[model samples]
Target: MELTDNLKRVKKPDWLRVKLPTGKEYVKVRGIVSEHKLHTICESGNCPNMGECWGAGTATFMILGNICTRSCGFCAVATGKPKPADWDEPKRIAYSVKLMGVKHCVITSVDRDDLKDGGSIIWAETIKEIRAISPETKFECLIPDFAGKWENLQRIIDVKPDIVSHNIETVRRLTAQVRIQAKYDRSLEVLKRLDEADVKTKCGLMVGLGETEEEIYETINDLSNVKCDVLTIGQYLQPTPKHIPVAKFVHPDDFKKYREYALGKGFRFVESGPLVRSSYHAEKHIF
Candidate 1:
């Protein structure tokens, strides 16, 4: 299907509209973020479920600053030359998690190809800092491919997070069209490296980007071949008009089928739905 031909703003389904609640943890987490002058993709990506997630004392922290170096057509993050890595950012992030009393934390970062180590040292430090403050909290790192750099990948692996994720973003056929400056083989190689390193690897794919069901299944097979432990499949929502458009919104039932299929294919965890991101409701699933 031609995704561009289907470009239109359909109202989010009722199931997707989450209600926000007030709580001590919510207020405390908000206050901490404000005090640290931190930015979260959970807020900046305009995540529809942010209120529900945050209200439930759950959050995904975006590290390595907000400005990304690569301009992937499907992403909402701004692409530009990023500022220098903040040495204190890790400590501040840890403080925010402590204040929130989060049981599980998802740490991700923008593509900082500008950095020599692709910000992997900062990622490692962030993981260590989070662990130091919240020893009982489960940690997940949804990292970049480090532009396929091994030195950068090794740094994060040395920290030994519970899960290390690098999103494939789209089907292999649409890789070139949908992902600017990202190669399909390079992504596969990243997963392969994670598998070889024996880390609990996770990868995600976005549908509604002109990819066929066969392509999606092929992607699942590819991820399985790389021994990825977690698979998250979600419908692609165009972040803006200039970005790649969604072909169609897969139904909730369809998502369930995909989830079942992924499980049958031997994924340890499958988070499949229109609203499922890499770290959505992560705390509940990890334990």
Candidate 2:
């Protein structure tokens, strides 16, 4: 069957429903984030489980800037001229984490092609600041591909985050359609670079973006070839009608099977399900 032809609306199974938002701690975290004028993927990216994640006292920091230079069809982040890097944003994030008493933190950002180093230097600084303030906290950087440059990738590796992640975003065949100027092999190389650095590497893919089952398995095999340590597979929920349309929603049971298959393929940790995101329950799964 053709990949785009896979479009078929399926019911959201029982396993997908989550508890609604309500928590005093969640409110406090939101207030802290607001006072700092910070941007988080939890809000800007329209993540499905923002309330649940914040309620648990964790948020994925969207550093560099909220605006993205690339217009990926699968994402909701605004596309425009990105603002200059905020040097103080790093220290603010460190202070916020300490205030939240978070044991671990996940930091991600939009594609900052407008910058000379693809904003890798800002990422490195942010990690350094976070480590200095909250020495006990573990940090994971979900980074851009630096437009596929080895030198740019090397810059962030120098910071030595606990986990370095670059999402393939979609299977090889659908990469051009789903992502903007992002190469499938280039992302694999990003993961490979982290693996070679002796740091834990993580990669994620969005299912139901019109990729074939064979393509998904091929993507998995490709990732395993790079020796990636962690994998996350989640359903694709179109952020808007203009964005890439969701072709199919895999059942939660199939997500389970895929998880088993990935684990059998030797990934140290695999998160697969309808609601799974790259940083979802990341702290629990990392150890």
Candidate 3:
């Protein structure tokens, strides 16, 4: 009975249904991604907007490697021992962005805990290389916390990606169960440091993970206190049965309320909805 009730609660709602993308542009982008051996969180993370982004001829490139060190419950990215950081990744990513001719590009990566510098050196080089070839293009880097090493974090800060993002993933109450090894306060510190640098800082959190409304507002208050520039709130979908099950499907109306509240708290931009992810509608947030 308990299992049946749980299954009922986890079923996806109608609003969450989406058609898979198909078009010449998506196929073209897929070929480019495959040809370059580039990794994209859009596919690795199992983001619902991957198809939509590809259909428009853009993609969020993932570096470091496809394998992640952490085992976050809500993520679809594979986890295991990752390969050594590839030195040539920056040039390949830059050329791919140039070839696609996108006005803006978002870059993200899996957690690489094995690295000494936490892959910060490659991160800095990637941004620099991208600027060298596509001087006109903009960058949004959704980065890791570097295991609380502020110096490693600074490498990314010095490069000056248009926006720096690191998702808290969920409210404080669910952080341990959802993000596993990630620390709730530490994620806040990551955003706080970015905010202090006077760079536009952003972070995302997923809903429908059994957190209360008050918990959500409390997370918002914490972000506001840190003066985070942008906030993205999205519904949590179960990537697999072995992963954490969805608590419930949050309604669109609740997402609207979240948007209004976040904006009131002084967020310059907020993307709140069922399909929103860390990089969803990323091009608009650069403003």
Candidate 4:
């Protein structure tokens, strides 16, 4: 289905509207990101929270490269043969975090399937560099599954970021449809392994992807079984005509219900809403 077709059939709800990016802090963060040749999921994914996050002087940095190897139907990150990994990228991101004076930073990246370790080396180095340069700043690594390679995941666990998050993206039935190359059970295993390693583990899911309420509750139970510490639920907006169309616009009340359900299910923290993203209100998840 084309983007225009979805637009014609489904009207965006009023609650989905977001403020245009502005303010000195937003501009300064934008400039720093540009000046340092850094890429962010905020701009790459066209996140609705970009304005608010950047305005607060916090942004999630996308490392390794802007291009991805997987063509997940729900993602907006470009997919293709990615450029070679940048060995110096870790130091640069570390310096950028120090310069931004970010108290709590979020780091994520495009899938680098072409790499041997799926860019886990860069992931670990980046965290180490940031810790060395800005000892007081806490950070979270929103990582990829690395095709469920335990050794590659070990690289990240060794660095010991405050939190390690791998997004489930959608329900089990929709995993193949939304995250074309990703496996739902494998993602659960990744979170489980992180929890086993004593690293704080987190996972995110997007609603409005044709998933039923029962399926969502089942997903929460699966995550809880693995001892997932934090959870984020958000409405999915189609980025282009080529992407999957929104199945529905969930109401704010439903989001609140989900949040309460997750909290009662033993999640340490939960962020749920129409505009929520994986990294929205990310700083609070540090606990």
Rank by lDDT, highest first: 4, 3, 2, 1
Tens digits of per-residue lDDT for model 1 on 132-186? 9899988888888898889889998788888888899898888987887998888
TM agreement with the true structure for every prediction? 0.93, 0.95, 0.97, 0.97
1-287 in candidate 4: lDDT tens per residue? 43224444468989999999999999999999999999999999999999999999999999999999999988889999998899999999999999999999999999988988999999999999999999999988999999988899999998899999999999999898788889999999999999999999888999988789999999999999999999999999989877888879999999999999999999999999999998999899887
lDDT of 2 by residue, 31-146 (tens): 98899888999888788888889998989999988899998988989999988888888888888889889998899999988888998888888888888989999978899999
Alpha-carbon RMSD of each model: 2.0, 2.0, 2.0, 1.8
Q: Look at candidate 1 and give me any clashing residue pairs.
A: none
**Candidate 2 to truth, TM:** 0.95
Per-residue lDDT, model 3, residue 227, is: 89
Model 3 TM-score is 0.97
The lDDT of each candidate is: 0.83, 0.86, 0.91, 0.93
TM-score, structure 1 vs. true: 0.93
Comparing candidate 1 with candidate 3, which one achieves the higher TM-score? 3
lDDT of 1 at 248: 71
Q: Report the error of model 3 at residue 154, Å.
A: 0.5
| Per-residue lDDT over 1-287 for candidate 3, one digit per residue giving the tens place of the 0 to 100 score | 22113554466789998879899999999999999999998888888987899999989999999999999888899999999889999999999999999999999988888998999999999999999999999989999999998999999999889999999989997888788889999999999999889889999989988889999999999999998999999999888777777887999999999999999999999999999998988999886
Who is ahead in lDDT, 2 or 3?
A: 3
User: Candidate 1 — what's its lDDT?
Assistant: 0.83
